[model samples]
Target: MKNRSLRIFLKIALSTMLLTCIRPAPAPLPVILNSPVGETITAADITFSWQAQQPAAGYIIQVASDSNFRKIVVEETVSTASANLHLKTDGRYWWRVRARNESNIWGFWSEAAFFILQRFRVVGALKTQGYPHDLAILGNRLFIADGQAGLAIYDISIPEQPRLQGKYLDSLNVAWGVKARDSLVFLAYGYKELVIINAVRPESLKITGVLEYPQPGYGYALALRDSWVYIAAGAQFIAVDISQPAYPNLRFQYYYPRNCRGIAIENAYACVACEQLGIAVWKLDTFPPRQTETFDTDGNARGVDCRDGFITVADGRNGVIFLQQDQAGHLTELAALELNGYASAVTIEDTLVFVACGSGGVAVVNCADRANPFLIATITSPYAYKVGAIPGTDYFFVLDRDLGIVTVKKEF
Candidate 1:
C-alpha cells in the first residue's frame, strides 16, 4: 500500500511539471508614434499620436529634452491614443509611449522617437519704402518693386543692412513686378505698360523702352528667358522680344477668360498661373508659341516656378503646390500642402522651395522626394509678398509688404 501511494504522488508531480513547460507566454504589445516623427515642425500646438494595441486599457506618454529621458518635460496617462499639447520651447525633443494591459500590467516602453522645432532663424531684416510687392537679386544688388513708390535698389553686400543705393518713383502708376540681369531690368508698370530700365547705372536708372498694351489691361507679372520676356496680364498672356532692349516689340499675345497672375518658364515650355482657371501652359518652340493645355487647381493660383521637370506654385489660401511635367510638356499635380497664411509667390532652388505667405509667413519646403514633400521651417511676418533664394547658399530673402526686406537662414 505504501509503494502504490508513493507512485501516485510521483505521477501527479510529473504531470504538473509537463504542463508548466508546454504553456505559451503572452505576446508583446507594440506602440508606435505616428506624425511629427523625425520631422521639423513650426507650430507650437501639436498632436501626439500612437498606434492602439489590442487588450490595452490605457497608455502613458512622456516627452523629454534629452534622449535618455533624464529631463522629462511632459508625462501623462490617458485612455485615448492621442493627446493635444503645446510646446513653448523650440529645440530637439525625444518622446516615448507605453500601454497598460487589462490585467493592470504595463507593457515595455516604445523606442524613443525624435523631432525638431523651428530650425530656421531670422538673421537680418530691414525696413523699406512703399508697399514692396516683389524682389530680384542680381549679383550684389537687390531690386524691389515698391508699389506706387516705384523701384528701390539696395546693395546687399551686407545682407543685414540693405543700404539704399538708388530708387525710381513712378508718380503716375505702381511698380508691381521686377526682374533683373547684368545691365537691364524689367518692370511690370501697373496695368498698361512693361518698362525696360538701364540698371547698369542704378542711381540714374533711365527707362530705355516701354511697350504699352492697348486699353484696359493689367500687367501683373513677368518672367525672363534667353531674349524673351513673358508677361502675365490680367486677361492676356504676352511674350515680348527683348533681343533689342531699346525697342521691345510683342512677339505673341493670347487672351484667356481667367486672369493671369504669375508666369514661369522651363526649357521650351511657358506656364502662366491663371487665377481661378488654374495653370495655362504654352509650347514656346515655335515663333509664336501655342497654348497646349490648361490645368485646374483647388485654390487661387497666384505664383509659380519651374525647373528641370518639376513645377511649384503658391496657391493663394491653399499654400504650396507641387507639379510634374512630362516629355510632351504636360503637367500633373503630384502633391499639395496647405500652409498658414496666403501664398502669393514661390521660388524653387534645387531641392528646396521657398513660398511667400502673406501675413501667414514664409515657408521653406524640402522637395528632394517629389511625391512626399514636407515643410522644413516657417519664418513668420506681418505681410510677406514675395520670396527669393540666394544661389549656392541656404539664405533666402522675403519681401514683406509691411516690413520691407527680411533675410532668413536655415540652421543646421
Candidate 2:
C-alpha cells in the first residue's frame, strides 16, 4: 500500500510538471501594427507589421487580391515581424501572417487584414469561354482569339453588355492573335498556321483560308495591310502574301536573335518588337527585307506602333518609349513613361497613348509633348494583359487573363 501511494504521487507530480513546461502556442494570432482595418492606401509600396511573439523564429506574410487567399500574389518569410511589399495594381487586398518557432513549430494563421487601393474602378466585365488571348474589332463586331476554343465572336454594338453571337470551337487549334477587317478575320494559332474566317453574318461564320508557317509556334502576332500580312512571331518577322485570302504565300522571313512580339508598318518600313533585341527597323520593299535601323531600349520591347514620323513601343517592365523618325528616316528616341510593372500593350489615339501594364493597370498618357509625356488617367486591374482602342469611339478594351474583356471609356 505504501509503494502504491508513492508511485501514484510521482505520477501526479510528473503530469503537473509537463503541464507547466508546455509553452503556450507562441501568439497564434498576430496583431496588425500598421494601417487601419479597411483603409484605402494610395501608395503602391506597402509595409506590413505585426507583434513578434516571444519565441517566434520567423514570420510569414501573405498578401492577395482575393479575400479567400486563392491566389497569393506576394508571400515572404522574415525573422522580424515587419515586411515591406510592392502590391500590384489598385484594388482591394487581403493579407495574413503566421508565426513559426525555432523548433519548426508553426502557429495558426492570423485573422486576415484587408485594405483597398482605389486607383481604378470596374466599368464592365465578362467571362470568356476560354482564355482570351487577343481580339480585333470591325464595326460593331468583336472577334476574339480564344485559346483551345478557337474563335469567338461578340456583338459589341452595345459595349456595356457584349452579346456572344457565335463561336467556332476547335479542340485542336489554340488561337493566339486576331485581326478583323471588313468581313474577314485573321486568326493566329499557337502551334502553327494562320486561319482566316469570313464573318459577314455573325450567326454563320465560315473558314475561308488557312496559312501554314515554316516554324511550329511562329504564328503569334500579326498585322495585315491589304494583301501583305506582317507577323511578329517566335524569333522571326514573317511577311505572308495573302493577296488571295485562300492561298497564303510566304514572301519574306527576317530572323532576329530574340523572340518577336509586335509588328508595325509605315510605307516601306517595318518596325518589329524583337523582345531583348529592341526595335528592329527593316526595309520591307526590298526583295529580301534589309534591316535599316535598330533602336535599343531598356525594357523587353513587346509591341510597336508608328504613324507619320512618330513611333511608340510598349517596352515590358521598362514602360513606354517614344521615338521619332528624322528627316533622313532615322529613328531617334524622344521620350518615355515609367510604369510600375510590365508594359504589355500600347495603342495610340491621336495624341493620347494608352498603355497596358501587366498587373499594374492601364495608363492613358498624353503625348502631345514629345519631350515630356504625362499620364492622363489610369484604369487599374491586377490582370491587365492587353489594351486596344475601338475603331472610332472614345472607348478602349482591356483584356484580363481571367476576367475576359473589360470595357472602359476615355473619361479623362
Q: List the residue pairs that clash in candidate 1.
A: none
TM-scores of the candidates are 0.75, 0.69
lDDT of 1 at 61: 90
> Any runs in candidate 2 off by more than 4 Å, and if so which?
1-121
- In model 2, residue pairs whose N, Cα or C atoms come closer than 3 Å (at least 3 residues apart or on different chains), thus clashing, are none
Alpha carbon lDDT of each predicted model:
0.84, 0.79
Model 1 / residue 390 / CA error / Å: 1.4
Tens-digit lDDT string for candidate 2 (320-362) = 9999976455789999889877887778878878787878777
The most accurate candidate by TM-score is 1
**Model 1: runs farther than 4 Å from truth?**
1-116
Expressed as tens digits, the lDDT of each residue in 296-388 for candidate 1 is 888999999988888888899888888998988788999999889988899887777789888888877889887888876677889888888
